[model samples]
Target: MDYPPDRDSWFAPLSLDLILKVLNVTFFHPFIAWIIPLSFRAQTMHWDAPPMLVSIAWAACLTLAWIAGVVNHRLAYGLPRHVDLSDEVIVITGGASGLGLLIAEVYGMRGASVAVLDVRDMENGEARGVTFYKCDVGDKDQVARVAAQIERDLGPPTILINNAAIVNGKPLLDLDLAAIDRAISTNLLGAFYTLKAFLPSITSAPDGGTIVTMSSVLGHLGAAHLTDYCAAKAALTALHKSLEAELRISHPRVRAVLVEPGQLSTPLFHGVRSPNAFLAPVVEPVDVCRAVVAAIDAGRGAHVATPFYARCAPWYNVLPAGLQVVARRLAGVDFAMRSFRGRLPVGENGERTE
Candidate 1:
């Protein structure tokens, strides 16, 4: 069941991101930049030559930039906590399929205690070292019950990845009240329910813990058709900020990671079109999962954004309202959801369809 190497070829294909990645590893690399000046000097070129001076300066700049990146991460996240896979227990909500399932499988195969809470049955009918719990994260009572069961069976969870999400990709005028409520409950309230149920256990664990929130770029730049979806994501982002601030003062040992990815190549956004594939390619779930896993494993807080464009989405908020509107129209953000068939039906399993 090996999937083709889509991610590797995806980044390799012609795109602005690929160009930057190549430059970063070659011309922009400090070691590679330094080699240029050294080679010129070896060829009997004078150090005072314009090319020599430029090369030396470029190399120094690259070195400084690399060091600054390290310093910034240190100041932002502090030191990383020790993480031993054998002693860690991970709880992932909505791990039946897509990104959540990918991460759950990886951790399970690595021998870490893994629990997946989902209303849907395991997509692959359960994997070795992974326990499946039939619980809807959108339901507080269900989440609480599952939390207790997980603790009793697999020990207190040290890593909580809040990845459950739903989208109602319809215009505000076209959406029904039920759709709006469902989007908010599943996308926003679900995270709160999980935190309420698991935070105590995480705090009580001797080794500390990690909480990962799955957010989206739409939260920063709301779209027309995805009103409810965007609103819920926006709330989630704000909640993550408030939670992190509180944790910083009360429990600094506990880490929080926020993942803000662009449109994903999953059924959640199936039939939707990307306005600019070269600049904003739809991200694969595995790419997002890899970043989440890395941040959790390092035991440091992180702001993970994928496809490069997502990292710049926040800057759109600083633009003038008129300009922002124009950008949205140009990017086809509002029209992107003209066609969206969700994973489940409207009333099935006490969940909403979008």
Candidate 2:
């Protein structure tokens, strides 16, 4: 489905994220920081001058911070595993559309064996090196059957992306049991089923594997009119953390990446409004995919958070209760879904209409 661009003012492009991106490369970078002092010296500035001293101190601080970050990552995730796409078989749930589809197509083009398991057909028909298997991740039996077929057809899986999800933008009182069940099963239990079915192969693979879980920032902060969706996403974050802990101890080579992104500009979130465009601009799916692909290609475990606000999710939980309420109100957390018109309406059999 094609989604039209959101209407915005000329300044819509000027976001906190854009400002930070510029600062990261020009001001915060170690190389750039050191260049300032070197340029000052080239201009015949005395070594003890205030400007020279400040520049040198700034460069040293930035360089040390960069080294500390590298050391922290090494201590936390250990060494990176090797990834050779040609020899890996990847399975992506909900690869028929959205972010999942983007990742599948990328790996397919790169000569990896990609199997997409979705209840719906592929949105763009056939893709090179990608085979579609119609299977609802919510159903354990269907997933089991598809797992066998994928193993037989494409060889053992070395990468699994648990990206299947469904959102019901309704208040708790308004949601039916069936809708609630579908949301939890698809968004939460679906990850468990996929991991159980494919983890063995991934763990046993000679090159190990990477497990990428697609979660959301909403998982950290609950929103109104999205009770079930929020609950399921929250559980996914917990699930990823626990699974990552176990994998690190028993299977150090297996990398587990947790992706918690802000609102995305996808058909899944069609008419949903952004509460604060400047502070919380809707992220493009391509940007999230770029981070994911980079992590997988580098064969490392990562926490991929998109948009600057997403990285601040953990901090939100530490705010006082009263302040949390104020933050919610300021962010319009509950009100943003009032105009939500998801991808399409659900059909009689629970499948979404194209």
Best TM-score goes to which candidate?
2
In lDDT terms, which candidate is top? 2
In order, the Cα lDDT scores of the candidates are: 0.84, 0.90
Over the stretch 91-154, how does candidate 1's per-residue lDDT look in tens digits?
9998877888999999999989999987777778979889999887878888889999999999
Off by over 4 Å in 2: 2-11, 346-354
Per-prediction TM-score to the true structure, in the order listed: 0.93, 0.96
Per-residue lDDT of 178 in model 2:
93
| Model 2 Cα lDDT, one tens digit per residue, 117-143 | 987778899999999998888999989
**Candidate 1's error at 318, in angstroms?**
1.1
Cα RMSD of all models vs. native, in order, equals: 3.3, 1.8
